[model samples]
Target: MDNGSFALMQQLEQLYIDHHSWLSSLLRRKLSNSSDAADLAHDVYLNLIRKGGVPSAENCRRHLTQIAKGMVIDLYRRRRLEAIHLEALREQPEPLVPSEEVRALAVEALSHVDAALRNQPSKARQALLMHKLSGMGHRDIAAELKVSVSSVEKYIASGLRACTPYAVKRRPFR
Candidate 1:
């Protein structure tokens, strides 16, 4: 590795050594589950590595806290979605349910979609959901939202753009 990469790795190693336990303890308190806390602590490091930042010693705790907080929120959202999906399945009259693998994939996709929509404006997210989930046309969405067709189109486009990164990342290799 080059000088910069070496330095970054060294910094990350030190940061992990210094803060992993503290972070894990914090997460344990917040999540009240040791396994989940450990997993999230590892995830926080992975996120930091992916971000390629060598956080300063003085600010590292705060930075790590922010990243961990976001991860915790994401974890909660995923669990909530899973609970809802299970409840819906239970409500169905038929004994049939999706296979475990299929359900896992669906939940993963739903989580990505939920994350993508989290940053969007309410109207934009609603328009996108109406178009994609409800199978509404642009004009129909506009009517429902009390906006023009052009506005609805823009909102859908924006939401799609936000979600495009996740879709692209998951595409199969040729």
Candidate 2:
């Protein structure tokens, strides 16, 4: 390995050795679970390694804490999203409920769709959802959205193109 890379690795190792236990303790107190705390602590170092800059010794603890806090927020966000998805599933009729695998796929697809729509205009997102999810015709969507039929088509096309990369292909269920 190159000298600089080797030096960075050594610094990271020292940082891990110095702060791991304290970070884990802090995470444990916040998370209320030893295993989750340990995992998150490990992830913090991994993030730092990926980021490739060593903090000054004086600021190391503060830097690590900030990274850990961001990780915790991301973890909480995922958990909250999963809870919301589960609650929505629970509200569906029993016969309409999907298998676990299907549900997972659906949730993943929905996440991608949501992300793709995030930067889109509100009317475009609404038009796309109405057409795809509600099975509304272009003309109906245009009427509902108070736009021209051609505008509805354009919006739907734009949204679909944005999400096309994330589309799940059909496969026979095992």
Candidate 3:
């Protein structure tokens, strides 16, 4: 390896020894996957090398943590986009081609929430579930529920609040 590359590798080895577990656990608490944490930690090391490597362990740790957190947020945002895209795809007979496996997981999450809402009796719940699973608009749901459009919107918002946390928790979904 080139001298610079070798030096960076050595620094990364030291970083892995010092803070890897801490970084992974921190990421897991705040983010989704341990694999994500490990990948981001490696990215932190790569960024450090690209920036000529930070001098102090304290600075490096802080920098790495910041990068890792940013990566976590970015990943979450991407997943959210994938979910939106997945819903939009269902409008078409053809499926949206997913570059990531998590897209299926996202669809399954929507399915789970839909299944849960099926047992609830509120017309509001039904309206919201129809919008979510069938891609119905507020006006459409309002017509079906015989409610005002604004009421349909409110139902959808409330339903999301009820469902989002539960959806986020059930991981490795089948």
Candidate 4:
């Protein structure tokens, strides 16, 4: 690695040595789970390493806290998505139940879709899910969202656009 990168790594290593425990303790209190806190603390450092920057000493705690908070939010969202997927699976008939591999892939895809929708407005996300997942028409979604049909259309379009990057190419089945 170049000198700048090497120096940054050294700084990060020192930072980790200095503050990992404090960060983990802080997260543990917030999450009320030692293991999750530890995992998120590690993720904070990993994210910093990925970004290839060491925060100033005075700002290190703030930076780490921000990363940890975001990670915790993502963890909660992922867990909720997984739980919802599992519940849906439980409702299927045994004969039509997906294989474990398929179930895993489905959950992963759902997480991707959730992540893609994370930044959309709440109404847009709700409208898209109601229309796509519940097979609700635009009028129905508009009624449920208490908006005009044109608004529902715009909301669904906004959600779909947010998810476009995560969309997989599909092939026609034989």
Candidate 5:
């Protein structure tokens, strides 16, 4: 490794030593789940490592906290989506309920879609959700989003393109 990369790694190690517990504690208080707190604490550092820089000492805690907060929000959003999916599944006929693997795959696919399009325009995300989940046509989605029908079509298409990289091939569920 180059000298700069080595120095950054060492700095990150020291930062982890200094801030990991504090980060975990902050997340635990916010999330009220120790396990998830620990997991997200690790994720925070991993994110830093991937970003390839250490924040200055004064800003380190703030940077870590921001990342942790975003992660916490994602965790809550994911749980909410999963709960909604579960409720819908529960309403289905027992015989029609999917296998556990199928259910897991469905949830994983939803997560991929969410993670992929999260940073896209809100109209895009909303249009796609309305079309797929609410079974609304483009005209209704355009009316709801207060955009032109063509704009709604573009939004849905953009959202789909964003998620294309994350798509997995489907297998027959049976």
Candidate 6:
């Protein structure tokens, strides 16, 4: 259609062809895996596709570099989350055969909290959900649940202690 838009697309395409390998090589040196770095470099192009159009070639290189960097940070976050989940799973009583069992454990934990809420009359269960499932801070949960900050802390601590026995226990040391 327009020369400006056409030029922009061409610039991004050429940038991908020229510097994608360079980006992967640099990212691989910094990260643990070359494939992951290549994937991130590829994601930068996919994101531009989603945005309807890429910027002019003059800016596309810089923008691609920025996008690649952000993707690296995102990968780190995902890795951290996976570590936390795996650590938690190791101490739980859930099934180990199927991969879906881990998701089931998360579901069961939420269900236990829900049942406790229905059983309790006051702010305890609500506080538990806010602190555990909703990711609220102690002070924030207290404010939302109309309890003291100390009470919120107590609720979370007690809940965790109460669930520890029910949690998945690790196997004996070899």
Query: For each candidate, what TM-score against the reference?
Result: 0.73, 0.66, 0.47, 0.70, 0.79, 0.51
Among all candidates shown, the one with the greatest TM-score: 5
- Please report how far candidate 4 places residue 159 from its true position, in Å: 6.5
Arranged by lDDT with the best first, the candidates are: 5, 1, 4, 2, 3, 6
Candidate 4: 10-residue stretch with minimal lDDT? 165-174
Clashing pairs in 4: none
Question: Would you list the clashing residue pairs of candidate 6?
Answer: 91-168, 91-169, 92-168, 93-168
Q: Summing lDDT over every window of 10 consecutive residues in candidate 5, give the lowest-scoring window.
A: 165-174
> Clashing pairs in model 2?
none
**Tens digits of per-residue lDDT for model 3, 10-115:** 8778887888788778877775667776777677667667677654776866777787776666566556766776677657555434435655666666566654
> What would the per-residue lDDT of candidate 6 be over residues 1-174, giving only the tens digit for each residue?
699778767867777787788777878887878788778878888878677676665776677778788777766755665566667777777555326675566545544544444445457656776777889898898888878999887877766665554465445656
User: What stretches of model 1 exceed 4 Å from their correct place?
Assistant: 118-152, 161-174
Cα lDDT, all candidates: 0.90, 0.89, 0.71, 0.89, 0.90, 0.70
lDDT of 5 by residue, 69-116 (tens): 888889889999899988999999999898898889888987987898
Can you give the lDDT of residue 87 in candidate 4? 94
Q: Give the poorly placed runs of model 5, Cα more than 4 Å off.
A: 119-155, 165-174
lDDT of 2 at 124: 91
Name model 3 segments beyond 4 Å from true. 50-52, 93-174
Model 2: lDDT equals 0.89
Residues 94-134, model 2: lDDT tens digits? 98777899879877886776678765889998999898889
Candidate 4 lands at a TM-score of 0.70
